[model samples]
Target: MAKKVIETSKAVAIAAKLCRPSVIAAYPITPQTHIVERIADFVYDRDMDSEFLDVESEHSALSACLGAQAAGARTFTATASQGLALMHEILFVTSGMRLPVVMAIVNRALSAPINIWGDHSDSIASRDSGWMQFYVESAQEALDRIIMAYRIAENKDILLPAMVCLDGFTLSHVFEPVDIPEQKEVDKFLPSYSPLYRLDPKKPISMGPIGFPNSFMEFKYQQQEAMQKSISLIKKTHEEFSNIFNRSYGNGLIEEFMTKDADYAVMAMGTITATARHVVEELRKKGKKVGLIKVKTFRPFPEEDIIKAASKLKAIAVLDRDISFGQHGALFSDIRSALQNKDIIINNFIVGLGGRDVTSDHIKTAFDKTIKAKQTITEWLF
Candidate 1:
């Protein structure tokens, strides 16, 4: 398989070709348009054996996905921002039913003032909805993670829906060189999805029905247990993918760059980590001890990995693309809770909201501020 430089749209089409979903339900929205448009073209060209459903609204898009998935078909969908908010109700239902539907969220800032640029608000709003979310920093990861998502979601121990998210426009519309595997290779890599349970007329089984409080609590408990079990299954799936693709995804939970012997570390997610890495390298050149921890998987939270990575550091800076009003950065709160016992100083920086550019210089400045604060303060926010 020869590597080729292709637009993000083409990369998604290539992923669709590999996944071979039986049903694709989506409502067009900016930034996310390229994904579904390419998939629709594949369906029209007869290159993919899937039903392209033009849903009336995002709510119906996910609702249709839920129905198709319950019928034991491989299902897929894509949405962003307001579109995702519209499907919020169905999102929870899909997870509770354990349908294992895979969705790609082009992470977009939510609106009251109407903005379509990148942010984590849309996905973070549904963080506790039982769906496993993976944030990708590049187009290659976006395509590759979707494949891994299906494998992890369909695991019998973790029959949960999964969301593979990428920053809108940043990776969605950017052109990059991606090595799209041959169809034969993809088929061998991802076998036919076999659901552990499905709605069959021959053997009628209840799904998504009204459960009383007594049984409902147990069902919720099972969902939590499944999420915990998915942590290991996610690692196993990544290993299998690496074996077949000859490309390792490091640790699927987190990717650390230059953090081995650093006194300060910056934690971030999505494409911002790419910028942070450059800043870390520049600081290292100047004899400044700095490193980065890029979080790839957000749902399971990767608490243990984060603590171990930040423990040796004298100070840590958390850069968040989303804010949690009245407090600090959304990820900052989570990181703080994870490191409460540790003696390391932590700083929170909220940036890149509503598509603000988070340049490498911005990251370097944050690091400088964090290191200075470490000399006297307990905690700092930039």
Candidate 2:
């Protein structure tokens, strides 16, 4: 392993290069631009060998990735808020086709107010794209998750696309020391792409054929079952990753920080969870039993892991960086569903939308309110 101080975007590109995917199709958009640029540099410098396609737009970028993966090539791409929105339609197509294309998303706010800063509005909105989603906490996890994404996506039983989301600017542009594994070790962890199905002349098999009312539900059910089964593979891949690299995040799902015996805890994803960790430490010094839960995997939702985390707490505060119009925060909504019909008190706090900064004090205030607040209450944090 080689340790180097670098921005998360650069780490993403480096990790993708190390994975040695057969093809990479991507277009540049802020925060996410640097990652693709670095990958291009590796190709230019002859450090990485892969088919790199610089498409016209985000939609075409993912479209190319889907095409490449369907042709039996392991593919990768990167995008952010507006770019992701443009590719929304193709996102479902990629997943529905059961192509295991891995993409890196730098989470940013949706435009209209014309903000370029960081938030979870982008990836959180794409949660229903039928792709396995992972929220990273730091540059190291960003690099590690990209590697794990490939393994998880290409799992024989789970052939769905995967997304590795890093907070735009917050984690993507932020510089930190990261220990990157060698290509040899990564090769051991993630073997070459041997897809179960592909489009080729020798193998005359039909894919995405016409699905009438009779076959449509069965196809949808197959996708659902694959996603449900991915939960175990996600955990298994994380364990295998840790066993080989000696690094992991809470069994590849919900990472609990001081939540075992706490009276109240905060649940969040991305870098905000890292900030809440500090707030948890400070609040503990003051004799307040506050904790933090960092969600690593979002899709397969980690419902059971979260229930276990909230089992001992008096209350759990869910901090969401994305707001659902006319309703509560997105992460908060998911947590409530996970702990449904239970007598658990879960408070919802919406903070850090459109790149607004969320300081440690703000997180501490949320914890204080959650410790005493009841369920069914949602508050906006400034």
Lowest summed lDDT window (length 10), candidate 1: 373-382
Shift of residue 7 alpha carbon in model 1, Å: 1.8
Worst 10 residues of 2 by lDDT: 368-377
Best by lDDT: 2
Error (Å) of candidate 2 at residue 12 is 0.4
| CA lDDT, candidate 2, residue 47 | 87
Question: Candidate 2: lDDT of 27?
Answer: 92
What is the C-alpha lDDT profile of model 2 across 1-382, one tens digit per residue? Answer: 9999999999999999989988999899998999999999998888889989999999999999988898899888999999999999999999899999999999999998888989988998889989999999999999999999999889889999999999899889999999989989999999999998899989788877788998898988999999999999998999999999999799898898887678888899999988899889988999987888888898979898888888877788888999999988888888899888678889998999988898998898888787767555788898
In angstroms, the error of model 1 at 44 is 0.4
lDDT of 1 by residue, 74-113 (tens): 9999999999999999989999998899999998999978
Per-candidate RMSD, Å: 1.8, 0.9
Q: What is the TM-score of each candidate against the true structure?
A: 0.97, 0.98
Clashes of each: 0, 0
